[model samples]
Target: MPYIKKDFIERLIDRVDIVDVIGARLTLKRSGSSYMCCCPFHNEKTPSFSVSQQKQFYNCFGCHKSGNVLGFIMDYDQLSFPEAVEQLAKEAGVQVEYEESAGHAPEKKEREVDFYDILERAALLFEAELPRHPEALKYLHDRGLSDDTLRRYHVGFAPESWDYLIKNLAGDNQKILKAMTDLGLVNQGQQGKVYDTFRNRVIIPIRDKRGRTIAFGGRVLDNSKPKYINSRESPVYKKGHELFNLDAIRNLRDKNLPYIMITEGYMDVIALEQAGIHNAVASLGTATTPEQMNLLFKQADRIIFCYDGDAAGRNAAWHALNTALPALSDDKQLQFCFLPPEHDPDTLVRSQGAKAMLDYLEHAESLPEYIIATLRNQYNVDDEGGRINCIDRAAEILSLMPDAILTRAAVEKRLADLVGWSQEGLHGSIDDSIEKLRARKAVRGPESTGAGGSGSRMDPNTIPLNPMRAVVARLVKDPELMRAIPEPDKLVAVLREYANDRCQVLLDLMGKIKANPDTTTGALLEKYRDSGKIGDLISLLAARSDAAIEEEGFVEIKIIDLMHYIKAILQEHLTARKQALRIKGRREGGLSNEELIEVQFLETATRQLQPSRKS
Candidate 1:
């Protein structure tokens, strides 16, 4: 990757409106000179995340994550460096110039913006047809959907004619056909003839979180061979990565107490939303993906999966549960609700009303209860062989979960009751599962380390005060200390050059401060408006009640400790570098006499610089 110039990054940061960017994702209320919102990264009742429009940076006093606009985009959207830069540039209305000969040109694809633009146009054309087309209107009305719901979902219709879209768009026939084919709106025959992929079908435009129309799903007006047809995976659309009705629900999230209600079909989502249950979303055509789970995690803390009380729904719930384990933290939760065996969300809301549906959700079976019930129905535990197989299968599934002692204990107790195993025997089985998990983690190696030596494996729930972190924290709290450092430029340079993980975000903020000496904390915080973690970092620093006063205070102690920490870090790097030299010598058909002497000299330098263990 071509190195992104610091000046370009700084310019991009300057151009962005931090409040506008962050306000899009979170609800912000003005507090003095800053804006406060509940930290979106963690479940917090209080507004710990502060956005400083003046500083152009954001920091969560609760969580110590700080960064600028680019950092905010990367964290909030889960975008890469280039993606975040591109997004910020778009937001700032700045066109990024690139040199083709500099090896930095974005790899061009034949189907680029034009494809998505065409799809958007196609969606609009389909949407226009909804009100006029009798079959489409009847299909929705028959499903108990209202005009408000249809418009909210941008429901549309694709006419049955093969050339309806192609001819009306007034583009080259071949190019139009190719665009339709690319979007999976039409099929190209062997002879290069074009035809409609969705005929007399109600179209639902599928958009990403950015609210750009990326794909479409069509449902036939009548009983058809294929019940629904969705756009194929293109440069833009991945069905598993998206959830239907997300665009609609996201709009209403601020006013309502957002709770994710997962239904089985697109119409089910529409029906529920029509009934004033606006916090509902659905899977595309298949089971939920981890990507979908992450998206849900962003909007709401509590997720209730409302599926039909049938075998298939139960199986889907199980799959969704497994997919969510890695992503779901203690703060985030998953609940399960099943409608009557024959009734879907649409039928339930229509028959019992929205109030009854909400009541059912509140009283629905817990995930564990649903899992146990599903297992018992699938396998007869009274049969000895069946019981053994069930226990083994349950153990395999439970082993996949991360360390959650209370939840694990509850699951184990339930498993023992179902299998009729003694508590002691079940304890042994749980231990076996834990050991397997540990072995797998060991094989995967340690979590990657950040530039500041903070390991990625460190849980966000537990904030540790290691020496390096203490140094960074002190710098964060007292920007004056930055001036006192002997080689401030070298220190900042090393931090920026080496730290590309979470810690790099901090380095970026520090770099900005160095560039503009007059930059204020409030401005810095606003710049990182999208970084919930940055707000957390600020909260962490601000929450420290003890002040450092010369030699007697926390500041002095931490500063002295930081100096030693820097020495230790340098020693570690030197030792690692020497080891690399030795390995290189062996790889080059054995070291020459001079090379061996030089290796010894390097080792001597490393040993000489090692920090005192007592410090």
Candidate 2:
């Protein structure tokens, strides 16, 4: 085995505090000297996961899963050892320094920090400019925005000068210019640098849930071609993936709030919060995304989508509903609300008091009711054809849900009532819709393969010549197995005789393990540089646990299955080679004597390796 670095491994583990790590994800209360919370890893009615701050470890009595900070991150975030270490290091403010025997170590760039710093500097500059710039000051005053509101939202202004931000930083001019360009603050032109991005506009700093300014949205004071101009998509700013006012709402999330109200624009969110409703946010000039939904799920138990009562607003609400269905779970609830016609949240709050709005939200109809009402208004469902169309479209939407049994039944009963059809007839329609959904799923399922190599299946016989899957499966199950397979070269030799592209990754991992046999699972998984293959490796390892259970007390079946799989792969390879030879023979008239002898030797080897086929 390669030499294990005891000091580095122990140091990495020591740096992480399990209590703090687990506490961040769950609400932990003190129980004696330790902290306890209901395990997030499993659904439990009572607290079972315990964190011992003294020992720097956590144990779940329910699932019997126990580990330190590294294990917690690995299980919770699904991160690798190295990734968990890096995360913990960041959390603990510890810099992990490593040395290599060969070549110079590559210097790490703090891209996230650089982006945040540049944005912070830019925000400060913009805030300074707002007071000095006459046009910017006039614009805010014209909008009737209060001085307190401006300060509360941190509203600022970017000057019209092209080199305004560039000259102020006084650092590397090129580096500053590139950073601005990266943040979409400036554009590169054919003639020279041009200020094609934000200029002479009121800027609103877009923050993440952590209150870090990740990007910005700027709106023109005057009648401009594009009324609102947002920061171009950057490394930190994903317009669809983030929501405005999330930072503020996150602060108040632990108040046992049952739901959060989602508005149509930033102003609506700001106005709602100022009106005493703090749990409101707006999408960044775009529809919500799955990532945003996931973030919301982490905070609130329910979401109330508040859109304008106009046709466009209803359409936007429909789009959000469709995007949300696949992600909606039993624990999460989704509902929709619309303001009075021609009124947004901002206008409504001014006209109707916050109490009236809150009452409306409390008594608002569910999403299904809103959807049905909207459809009925659009199409007259009194007619037979119209009723049929409504059922068809509604069924299509419901089918997208992974577990819509109750929802489907409710919709079916409603449809039967509307269409004046029998309950049995509506039941039959739902069955048909379910069958259609199943057919669609089956068509999209992974293709199957046959032994003949002519069917429309992914041929299991043609395993790639990389044993990464096998190697990772074995390593995760029993890292001590590395003692038997000490060298990567020898492991490769064993793997090359079989099929599985994962073997290549496993060989690379083995090389690392041989160098550091004491390497923890966290470390091994973290150093795996290729993300494209990591998921596959993880799935393979997870599958091995089941395979191990099945193999217990039936050693012969395991060996036979492995041999059979290997033989099938070899057969596929040999078949392809024979076909290639036949094509070459057609081109060159016939095979040479030496080529024929080689073919005979390959055939003999294949025959010796082929396992008997049994029923």
Candidate 3:
């Protein structure tokens, strides 16, 4: 591991061009002493996100996300402090000097350097083997990969014979062979014979973020089990700690828009690049870890979790969601998308055009949406007990959420509606259950939040109506009003009904617009042309574009007053819930000493909300 010094970080931050870093991703218009743009952190049509050049700081007035350059990168791009600093330093062409400590002594440096040198030399030898193998060359041509792509990615072929690699390391150097074994590239047999670890496979070199090849991924051309074999973790490469194509992603990071993607395979990422999507990466064969997520988020504004569409794929996505939820932020977006069943991105793009693949991405569901889908897929949502269990599952996962009240409330409401419960009933029930679970966890030890769903997993997610359709429609008509779409909790008050649930695709459209400000209604119509009825609605809206966008008579509702109306209704639900609790207490030997205080608080709160609810 490379140790970064505090002094080095301070100097890097002082000298780096933050404007250049941020401006490269999105267009920033000048606004007096600062730059202004739409806040990428949340849904908005207004330019509330601002950066002060003089102060070298950024703050979104709407979302209230503020920070200096380092903080900005960490929040918006999802990077760590040290990674952000190193990225800046590399751009500035400065050598990063680390402070020496007892842990990082000078004596340990030279041996590590030799390990790196051996890996570099071994990569060169692997590259040389490609031309010598005609079958491997044919495979590359069959994939339609250009020579430039092959060289750019450092594609290679390892021979089928066991001794091929060990035989040709320039001078039969045993010292190099010993180091190769230590790196896990060669194996010593039970009889003490040495042979290559990766043979009869096409080799794909994996590099560290700094652009040095540290490991390899071998794909078998013939029908075989374990189709892909990655390097065993070594001193230079840590398993589940490195991302494939990371070095290439770094080269294109600054120029792309507010997002990048994470795929499950090496070929998927490479295929995406060939199809003009340069901002993507893949995790090492395992599921994404918290450490890897931190590194990935720092590189872009949003992350698309693209995987296969099989049973294994759904389970993988579920695990990714559980691991990611504990760290979920209000503004950091993670989307889940799957390729058509029986096809990976590589084959999918080959058969369909890149636009078809992109359209699927544009139609992908958000993390909350995907979680609901996955949970629902496993349960019988039409049954009463099934619904309770699904919500129980939701509570178990959501209790780990860091600090997102509004977002959590919105999700809980949606979950309740799916199970045919009134929002108030589900809210009270889930809250009681969640508190009980928390107390249990407090007394016991921490349990693992793994691929296990609370009960049998629910069914795949169905589209919940964005009940705020009447409101969302008026906002979508203006497009500009989307900037004021309120926080999620308030937004949920309008979206809790399933009557106009089909309108959600329209609501999801706003996210696309926020990511790409130049997006037009016509573009959206074409993008969702196959989305059935929603497509027809957008088509009609596109046809009367003049009236919806240019004309003066479109209904212009007072959104603030509407939101206040929704807030009042929510408060009434709470008041009713508290009143029920008191009534039940009276029927069952009166309120407890602890319950008395809660009853008092509710009485005061109910009186406060009565006037607002009446409004």
Q: Model 1, 1-615: lDDT tens per residue?
A: 344454576567766668889998889999866789997655578888877675566766564554556667766775656778778788778876543443554433233338768888888999998888987798788888888878877899988787777776635756666667777877788997777777778998888766789888888888876878888887678888788878766665555344788887877877887787878888888798877887787677788998888889878888988887666555566789988898999898988899989998888776578667767887889999898777777776676565663555667788889999997898797678657766877877754223211111232336676545555555554554555566877766554433334256456656766877665443454444345656555434423323242123365566666567665555555566567777987788788787678678757756765655874
In candidate 2, how many Å is residue 338 off? Answer: 0.5
Off by over 4 Å in 2: 1-14, 23-35, 39-45, 48-87, 96-113, 133-148, 170-172, 422-424, 441-615
Question: What's model 1's overall lDDT?
Answer: 0.70
Best by lDDT: 1
Residue 481, candidate 2: Cα error in Å is 13
Model 2 lowest lDDT segment of ten? 449-458
User: What is the C-alpha local distance difference test score of each model?
Assistant: 0.70, 0.66, 0.67
lDDT by residue for model 3 over 1-615, one digit each (tens)? 457776566556657555676786668898865688987555578897776554454556565554456655545544445666666677789988776787777544534447777777778888898999988989888987778888988889888888776777524776778778878789888999888899989899898877778889999887697889988998778867788888777766545456777888888888888888787788888898876776665566488888789988888888988776655666567788887788878888878869988888898887678867877887888887887789889888777676444657777777876888888888888788878888988877655422211111111122222333334333333445555655743444333432124335544766655655443332333345346655544433322212233333443444553444444544555566577777989899898887788678667755765654443
Q: Write model 2 residue lDDT over 254-307, tens digit each, in one string.
A: 466678988878877766766788888899988887667766765676899998
Compared with the true structure, model 1 gives a TM-score of: 0.75
The residue-level lDDT of candidate 1 at 475 comes to: 56
Candidate 1: clashing residue pairs, number:
34
